[model samples]
Target: MSARDGLDADERHLLVVDDDDRIRDLLKKYLSRAGFRVTAAADAGQARKLMSMLDFDLMILDVMMPGEDGFSLTKSIRARPGRQTPVLILTARGLPDDRIEGLALGADDYLAKPFEPQELLLRVEAILRRAGPRPVVQRRLSLGPCTFDVERGELSRDGKPVRITEAEAQLLRTLAKAAHAPVDRLALAPDATDATGRAVDVQVTRLRRKIEADPKNPRYLQTVRGVGYMLAPDE
Candidate 1:
């Protein structure tokens, strides 16, 4: 297997929301190098925006921020519809009640500040392992005017070949394999080095432009809130 295959075999995507620039940057760098995809946000506002666009396997939230603290944010995320992406709250305050509150609000785990990076990594791995593996996917898909062959990694629209970049082809194949199921952005990444899953997002946009009548409001290539992209092929 290649190095990328060995490193973060699952390619889980993580979101780190913290007001502390130093902390956020450190976590992003550390997590990225460790083989997992990481995205950082300065505050709840930025986190919400990121969450709206990308699907994350886990979220690391710093409990104290200027607006909408981690606790409140966690509550809001759980209240939202669809999959509740696992949340790991980080706080300087190590109070038992704080941990209880976070858990009650739907957080999967809690880590106090000044934690060892290794411990955090281990916790993340444990949480994901518990989240379970993605379901098996179908081999073929029908997307309105488009038909995708997962094994061949080919897409055709209206009985005509629709040219796609190698990157787009790979992404389509991944999504096709998991048709009707949410595929995490990181899992669809062309390579392991795409730690932020930004490359995957770009490819999805291009694919939507070609497949959807209106890319802005996609029907087949849909975003599963708090999860990732799902290909809703015709039955």
Candidate 2:
């Protein structure tokens, strides 16, 4: 039986960042065969650029790159505001301290060089499994006095229809879909050409005004520090 027998390879995308072209290509080919869409970056700079534009299910990073090593890259990634994509550190440094540091820096797993391809595939699968599936968005969400119907992208306050722009409705639906989980600002403004997430911030502010009793201190549309915004619905 094939390792990827029942897996949906087309859905999960992986980013492989390594300085060595040979190892990077080999890993990409092997993982692709194992049922995953793969993209490769030669260094942290390239990896960062790719991350800004595309979302990846997981990252395979080499720890010994020339500029901004894997450890540093991992730290920066964790510190940044947005999705905390799972990372697996692949490196020649197999020492105890190295592994400890990688985990401490928020890496999902650590694998030393001279490792078997089968072992690597297993580790990748394990990490993806641990990350779990995406949260299922409820059709209806309660935000204090305001209730949102995700299916219709409609918001009502105290059983009365609330006036909202199409843009606001779209934003609210996006937030409601993630309900309680932080939705990346970029993800919120999928149509906006602006990459700074300013458009998302504006939309959130507008949505909060309608749904929050105190827009100054939002209760439902809450900001996630160093991440994005989360929709905390009333139970």
Candidate 3:
């Protein structure tokens, strides 16, 4: 599968967790044709089992299930120490509040039940683009209570996302590349050619608020005095 929208389709593995056999099969077929490797589970139990053995690029979880509901499952997954898997929730009860709750619970996107296959594909592709790439490398980095999945540009604390802005993610990506070493402020910008030192510092302070227990005295992301900043991987 060729890469689409910066997504390496050949390496994209999606987990479809739905108790409805008809919907699950239909989604699996549709998404597979769209060049994603789809794995379907009948319930959260089976989904959790598959998750343990595989690293999925994204998960499509249903809101209502027999034992463990999608909300609870998403919460549980987000609560894990290192897993920052993106989740897209599906539900028949597509109230405004429901969508808000799902988003608040750390879901990347949500789809109301009875959505068209094409719509689903569109949303999936959009989310994948927003989620970014899975670069082929030793890409996982620990930052205290949080872990950064370098390729995915995801930073999470105990599996819950820290919600860094795009620029901040770009900065972290640069810092993560040279963990234990200082990265120049200009080099931390999304575009080093146009970024100002003050802009970089502002972003660093924002990131520290999320990653550091005390932003005043940072532990993980540290200023290197005159050299710029360093991300110490010790914590």
Candidate 4:
């Protein structure tokens, strides 16, 4: 698969979760054409059902659902062994806290509402490349005043222990890997689903609440406008 919009196009399986049929079907078609096998869910509950029924290489989860939102489902999936399956979160709230929240939830990446499909493709490729067993330094990161240990699945500061929800850890890990460079918002989206850059922005903002000392003028996570996300992997 060729890389475009700074997103990669590796062939893979993707699961999309959203309440809206238009978004779900649109993503299913877009991702499929992008060289991925796509499955879809209307909400977290449906996503859970699909998870129980089948295996997907990647998942795209919607944050606001009727019940059992994306964050909840991500936590549940994080519990299973080797279920470290990558996830790209979807949300309408672009607040920093919300972005941080999704990262804290174990999502591989995220996308905000009103995003471009081409951007989503790029984001998917970035995640897929980083996940591969290459010597590339895409998966380790540092947040201000703290360290996010992706391999061990832990977040800490000054060697002090911090409790991270499984979902949060996943988000942190995803950003951490791309700490060396600015990971585009599109690259942080679900491989199987389509969402906007604004949504990814929200998830990043939420992650800051847990890592950065100040969410505003963040010291660790920084935004690269018209591009994607940049994580300061170390102090």
Candidate 5:
């Protein structure tokens, strides 16, 4: 429950993106009281604007938006470079297939509409724990021109903070620990969820944007084709 100021840089900043005003306000208030710097977005457009304007540690996106649904938006983020933030999909769909679709689009977690706030808090905390950013990094790691601090989950270049998606942070931590070993797509799925192979591919695509200088021909995070995915040498 720590923050960047008094706590650590590893503290999480949350964005709650939903079309429903009541849900958004409630989540923002509740998450704030739980020690998160939260922002709200009514739709994909506003979420895009907020993304353009600020950095969020994690994003909670509603699947049923007006134009750009959460899946579509997740696809857009996956397509871009330097934006690998972690995403959690919130929807009424409890179907495994529906959850798979959201995960395939690069969402890290999924929760149904009638979910408990405490459970939501737990999920949020779990995602943040993966990245471990906010307070400060205890160790320093070098990745090409950029650097990642595993303990703090912060990535920086030349002493300047570089914005990375929460997904990116999670990937970096995962790959960093594995070093040169390849991490399977299934290995990246949310702890308690059953995710399909397609879902893993989406997460990898989104992660490449933040980690690879050339997402098309990634050097650091690489694909093993049939074998699965692995982290290229950090150097």
Candidate 6:
């Protein structure tokens, strides 16, 4: 297996370097909601500072900045003694040569500007998935009357195992990672399936049956109206 296959969704850290304030903030918020710890930098200088302080899993860079453009910084990163962090470059320059230059400078992937956030997310996932599989850390999450163990893929209440399907376990793991935050249904199911939104709703309903004391009025797993589902684990 390639190094990318080892990366798990949880515990992935990203560094987003962009000069545009709006794009930087938007990507930061969006990726954070998607269950990744994202740190933003306004330019190459700030990116260098952050890189010196932290070890990031991946980086999202913009090419056309005021100074020290993405290509130069990518080349510098590649030249570093032991820095092989995956990089995905974003720029308004859509020329074939521009993409070639970015990739040649050690970028793992490149996307032109005016792209959909969903598409950007898919690219990020794709790049990270290629790195390698990450070790699965066992964690026990509290949900009012029950405890869900991520490593064992088991849920128990009052010392008894509560039967749950594999799909349900996967859904719970995804939600538990971002507890108290709304998770988009599209993030839950990325495949081109018909009526995916409705399908996620069905899955949520089934999950409620196993966890909620009253499925009609859930306590821990609550729907955020037009947004999506949020897991408010018991404190």
Best by the TM-score measure = 1
| lDDT per residue as tens, model 2, 12-124 | 88999999999999999999988899999999988876665456789999999998899999997786544578999999999999999999999999999989999999898
| lDDT (Cα atoms) of all candidates against the true structure | 0.81, 0.84, 0.81, 0.71, 0.73, 0.81
**lDDT per residue, candidate 3, 1-235, as tens digits?**
1236457675799999999999999999988987889999999888875654456888999999999899999987776433378899999989999999999999999999889988888888877787777644357788788888777878899989778776777777667766787866754552335555888898889988888989999999999987789988753
Q: What is the TM-score of each candidate against the true structure?
A: 0.61, 0.60, 0.57, 0.53, 0.55, 0.55
Which candidate number maximizes lDDT? 2
Better model by TM-score, 4 or 6?
Answer: 6
Q: Write the per-residue lDDT of candidate 1 for residues 28-141, one digit (tens) a residue.
A: 988887788889999998887666545678899999999789999999778654466899999998999999999999999999988998888878877777777633345668
Q: Write the per-residue lDDT of candidate 5 for residues 115-202, one digit (tens) a residue.
A: 9998998888777777655533236677666678766668886778878766656656666555666656654543315566676677
Worst 10 residues of 6 by lDDT: 1-10
The clash count of every prediction, one per candidate, is 0, 0, 0, 45, 17, 13
**Candidate 6 residue spans exceeding 4 A from truth:** 1-7, 134-235
Candidate 4 lDDT tens digits, 40-154:
8888766764554344667888888887788888886775533367888877877889888888978888899989998887787778777763233333355656776667768
User: Lowest summed lDDT over 10 consecutive residues: which window, candidate 2?
Assistant: 1-10
lDDT of 6 by residue, 35-136 (tens): 788999999988876665456789999999998999999997786533378999999999999999999989999999999998998888888877765433
TM-score of decoy 4: 0.53
Overlapping backbone residue pairs in candidate 2 total 0
Candidate 6: lDDT of 94?
Answer: 94
Candidate 5 TM-score over all chains jointly: 0.55
- Stronger candidate by lDDT (3 vs 4): 3
Which residue segments of model 3 deviate by more than 4 Å?
1-5, 137-235
Off by over 4 Å in 1: 1-10, 135-141, 146-232
**Which residue runs does candidate 4 get wrong by more than 4 Å?**
1-11, 133-235
